[model samples]
Target chain A: MHYTEQSHTFRKIIMTKRITLADVAADAGVSAKTVSDVIHHRGRMREETRERVRNSMRALGYTTNLAARTLRTGSAKLIGLAIPNFAQPFNGNYADIVTSYAWAKGYRVSITTYHRLSQGLRELSADAYRFGVDGWIFLTDTPIPAQDNFLNQDRPVVLTGDYLSHGVADTIMFPNVEASQTATTRLFELGCERIGFIGAPANADSLDVTTQQLDAALTAQEGNSAMRLRGHLTALLQHNRSPLPSLVGACTRLDRSDGEKATLRLLDAGAQFDALFCANDAVALGAMSALTSRGLRIPEDVQIIGFDNTPDAAFSSPRLTTIDPFTEQYAQMAVDCLISRLEGDETAPTVHITDFALIERDSTRH
Target chain B: MHYTEQSHTFRKIIMTKRITLADVAADAGVSAKTVSDVIHHRGRMREETRERVRNSMRALGYTTNLAARTLRTGSAKLIGLAIPNFAQPFNGNYADIVTSYAWAKGYRVSITTYHRLSQGLRELSADAYRFGVDGWIFLTDTPIPAQDNFLNQDRPVVLTGDYLSHGVADTIMFPNVEASQTATTRLFELGCERIGFIGAPANADSLDVTTQQLDAALTAQEGNSAMRLRGHLTALLQHNRSPLPSLVGACTRLDRSDGEKATLRLLDAGAQFDALFCANDAVALGAMSALTSRGLRIPEDVQIIGFDNTPDAAFSSPRLTTIDPFTEQYAQMAVDCLISRLEGDETAPTVHITDFALIERDSTRH
Candidate 1:
């Protein structure tokens, strides 16, 4: 454990060649151990001796292999963080948090981004092996690659996002579907009828299983679209009451551009919706612009709700009502998962699904 | 280059023996060379033979020795992109670009962020050795680590933004001083002279040499507070010699928040400059917001110019007139410098500086 043989090599070379530690020790007239201790500065050496060793080391090109020593002990002092992309604000903050966290732990982190999902996941696994990282935390949107056919290097991998249906890896995910259901139920209780939904379509290409589950939960309460409408019409006929209007259609890709087009299309179709629910703040912002351009007042003409409580949401023209996806909580959870795995918590692949909160602002006051 | 001796002790016995090339070749009834060509998909292997080898490989569970091969060749296929932080929008895009570029080149990029300047440089040097990165491209705002004694590891280290001071390393920088001169000269040519500066203090803390150079360049032409005020006073010396107005003091930090605060303070101080030149677009935006809030029309009342033609500059309310800092071009040059070093071009360290372009937009076109 002491690596005394390598220390002998250091002693032999420094003894014969340029300025020997003995020469400095003779000048200072201290024991070689004292000089070595002073050179390493690891233990108690007189401050004066320490300064003299510091000057002696500098005077004689003494670059100790502390880094190499750490490496030889099978610990690279490195952690790996992988993300889908660094462009999105959410992922950007995620990258920042992981970097800060690793730095705080006295370990340096090396991050890698992959554009192609599968390749990203696979490459990260390969990197874990080649880099000999202490552990890996993957905040990715890609599916897990095949395991039996993996490169056969053993290392712990923690996946962020619970939509891990692959049944192969440990994961941490936010409760996306339950949160959406909660938001919808709250809107229904707010005496709002004829609510229109504007968001990206739930489809295979989207691959958002969490959102799809939310749609199912909502549909269960409202009944199938056509059947629900028919049932509402029947109830109305009996009570001489008007039927409630339902979501018209979901837009695919909920960016501002998508919101603008979707809003215009909804207005042109003469849908009498009193409230609009958007998938994210960017879409809601666009919808608000479109409605205001048409002289409709927020919560007066129509109410709007958005998801993803981004920082900008709080400061927009009319403060946006959104769901706090708790990106920080998610990031913390991912880190915890990775750390646990690295510590050998190999109890079957675990999943953590966090809850979401709805933050009400001026947009949804009605 | 051929590893014919496949009889390492570790390879001979294992708890669960892994399939190897010889097993796959034996299963396919072909030489290992034929299987190698099929696996690498190198030259021509008959479709029938390729399929036989592939099936045999699958049946035997053969895995490639890419790690061993990389170790043998000293090409780990990893590159390092060092940045100040990952969250800043500008540097975020830089990280993304380098990652995308490296991936396209069939190499992986590891990112290292240094929150503090010294710690970052130390980690970068250590990582260069530990991670087996072939080259390094450093885009930092602070000075390179003084203790970067990488004489032991002569891996390529190319820098951006004139960050390195005494270290003998390759660096790429933009013409910050010349660009500031150009921005000021262009304003001078615009005929309105009651100009005031609104930006971070002339001496920003922890700034690199290029920043100091830019400050010198701006001050060189009429270069002091009194001279600047005199230039502004001369502009108004034309009401038939118009009455001169006093120039304002420099604002520090040069961000949107600081810009707005400085603008409000200047307005409160009754500074009556006809034109305002800001440190950057963020400052210009903040100033524009303050002006709009005070009902002061742009160009009609106060023409403004800014530096750093960021993406949003072209889309600002009255599009911002700015200096195109060419961040992307900077990134490309840093990459070229790093690749050249990785490919063994350790020519004398030279400063690679590119020019900035003056982007005339709505803010400056009276």
Candidate 2:
């Protein structure tokens, strides 16, 4: 579609003369008021007249100016999603699902990521306002203060991922504790004893706080790694098995490289275990790689399990026995909650709990 | 942040007031024009007065109304990105990188996904205008029409992935042809006389169109899979090797399951091959799984390579040897091109080519 210089200039002149409702009305041989009424879908109009006006508008290349509409209605029909980072596979996948669902509900998504871990929640709140979204969904690992007035100001907010106790925001909490217990019990049922645990090794001291005390305290205050550790310990005690310090590997970050390093550390220290539980699927993958490199046969010599059944879990060698966090359901619930609030639901903030399931694969023998 | 009912009501009342420049000026003890000048940084002002006005604006909780500013300046300071599907790992990672970089440059990102493949490019054009973004960067696999008037109307657009010849939109094409040739040549250098190519096998007929004619023809009309096939054949001919039809495995989709299915069909048909090159990392991962499941040893029995060095590529059992398409750089280039256009660069539509590298790993012997 090569355009001559003269045609390009002509097109520019036409574009500068902005298409208006009056132009469409003139083209359709109708009053400007009738065109305006048809655009807003107000009052009654003949079907033939409405169709003619719409056709004329389309032919004239007229589009409603969104800026003017936003200014008049004070609504952008936009939703803001603030996350720690999308580099993590789980976060990226979640963002994709949420954005798709939101679009179906007639809302566009504006995404922002907090690259610095230290300032995640604070930065999220600040950026949410800058984006000027009608509503917001924030995913954070850090504990947000209860009195964070900026977050609770004017719009509906939904918190996801780790638990948070915000005054005005609804929350959808991941069932980390129950899911972890289920995975650990599954390992025991498979006739594996001396199970090893790999997760946030840096939080070992916090994990030592008895499960009862941890439960009694505000679970929202505890981080994700701490909650998973509690589940592992609770299940171990329930099965009449003691969790030895040597069998537990703590990692600073819950990623593949950290998982491998933590697993190798346990192995080098002469830790003996027949099964291993990891913080997430990434950790499990790294742990599996380390185990294989050391000449250990999976399911025969050791059973392994992980959390967040990511896409790669099913394709990894020996597959992966991991927990499915029900991310799709979580995203739907979060959006539904925000939409309800947007539609003028003034009820108290509710905590929506999501379910989890243990996906059995070749990593563990039945 | 627990808010009392009365406090919530008070906040709602304050929100209804809608802070304006006049309100800020009154609070700062200055004229409305002076406030406007400080907001826009139009002229020099005393540092002390500027600091006082900023503090007053913060105390009064005034935010620049984006809608009004956009209406006046005709710039939204927002960029829209249209992608095929975010569930795909590659697209998700690309979106993440692009969003991060765009944010650093002071532009917010609006993201929309085309769930239905059939209506991807057409729907993208419609949605981009509706979003009212300052500019757009579209990533598409479908062949867009050269004279897509909707896309070329009144905005800067940069197309990514696959070669396209849209007259007004800049293009940042992935180095598919050269990268495929390099991977195929590497297999030959390893002394593999018979190498199998598993990719969009549907392009087999189009692959026969000779490199010269294919290059001379509109490359945009050819899909990515076909271009990759041409590269494979070109490298084979350059090495004085003939590609056998029996050694080619065509896949309907570039996902893991399809890769596995394609590889199985090739194996079940008793195709003799000593090496394999997959279209992308996911397919390569699936092919590795299928090959290993059939009691084949990697490198020793069959060397393999894949494209797009996704995170999983490094963690796969053999740590897949694949091509790095420089997705981060591709994203940066696309965003930079659009930004330059947004900032008043009226030169001809430029075709930007990105570099690719073969990342050696355990999948192929060193």
Which has the greatest lDDT? 2
Complex DockQ per candidate: 0.21, 0.31
Residue pairs of candidate 2 with colliding backbone atoms: A146-B1, A147-B1, A201-A250, A201-A251, B201-B250
TM-score of chain B of each: 0.67, 0.81
For every candidate structure, what is the RMSD over all alpha carbons to the true structure, in angstroms? 9.7, 5.9
Where is model 2 more than 4 Å wrong at Cα? A1-33, A38-43, A47-64, A116-121, A127-132, A201-222, B1-44, B47-64, B116-118, B129-132, B201-222
C-alpha RMSD over true interface residues, model 1: 9.6
**TM-score for each candidate, following the candidate numbering:** 0.67, 0.86
Task: Write model 2 residue lDDT over A242-350, tens digit each, in one string.
Answer: 6677777777768788788888888898889999999888889989988988999898999999998887888889999999989888998988888889999999998
Q: State which docking tier applies to candidate 2.
A: acceptable
lDDT tens string, model 1, B112-177? Answer: 777642445544554454555677787655444445343224466776645543446776776655
DockQ, Cα level, model 1? 0.21
Candidate 2 on B108-188: residue-level lDDT in tens? Answer: 676666664234555445344346677788887667665444456566778887757556678888788888889999999
Given candidate 1, what's the lDDT at residue A182? 54
